[model samples]
Target: MDFDNFKTLGEWDKWKGALAKAVDLGEAIGFNENTVDKMAYRIGNFLSSTVDPENREERVLQELWKVADESDKKVLAKLIVRMVEKDSRLH
Candidate 1:
């Protein structure tokens, strides 16, 4: 499910599902709702900045850091990158 074009309720539903999955992953790795929310927010923005889509590890990390708190930033970046990377591997 892509969020770049998500505008309608149906699209949001899909995004919500994906967000849930990400949150689940976060919890699996020892993150709380507040922390996961920050990560999900970063993920949304990162997906929106899709240019070539292959990915820039540093750029993604930096953006996630920019959106997340000092303490949560690294953890959130790791979660988001791993999610995108894992999905990309299947594709």
Candidate 2:
């Protein structure tokens, strides 16, 4: 996946759509939930460190990330994965 394209479409919905696609791809390629959750955690860490939030939701997430402990962050990552999974199902 070329995230350069996604960077251009910077809306929160676009971000969620990209996440949904990534989740689908991961599943299609036989990544288990734990693997995917770890991937999401890494991505979240990277984004929190390197990227400014593009929207209110993202800003909120960044703020939460700033305050969360490792275990909490993992739980947050899991919730995000579940959220996107449910979101993708709706579309």
Worst 10 residues of 2 by lDDT: 4-13
* Model 2 lDDT on a 0 to 1 scale: 0.90
Assess every candidate by TM-score: 0.37, 0.87
RMSD of each: 10.7, 6.4
Query: Tens digit of lDDT per residue, candidate 1, span 1-91?
Result: 8654344445534544565566667778998756765776566456646633223444454565557665675566456545654554454
Q: What lDDT does candidate 2 reach at residue 39?
A: 97
Instruction: Give me the candidate number with maximum lDDT.
Output: 2
In model 1, residue pairs whose N, Cα or C atoms come closer than 3 Å (at least 3 residues apart or on different chains), thus clashing, are: none
List per-prediction Cα lDDT, in the order shown. 0.56, 0.90
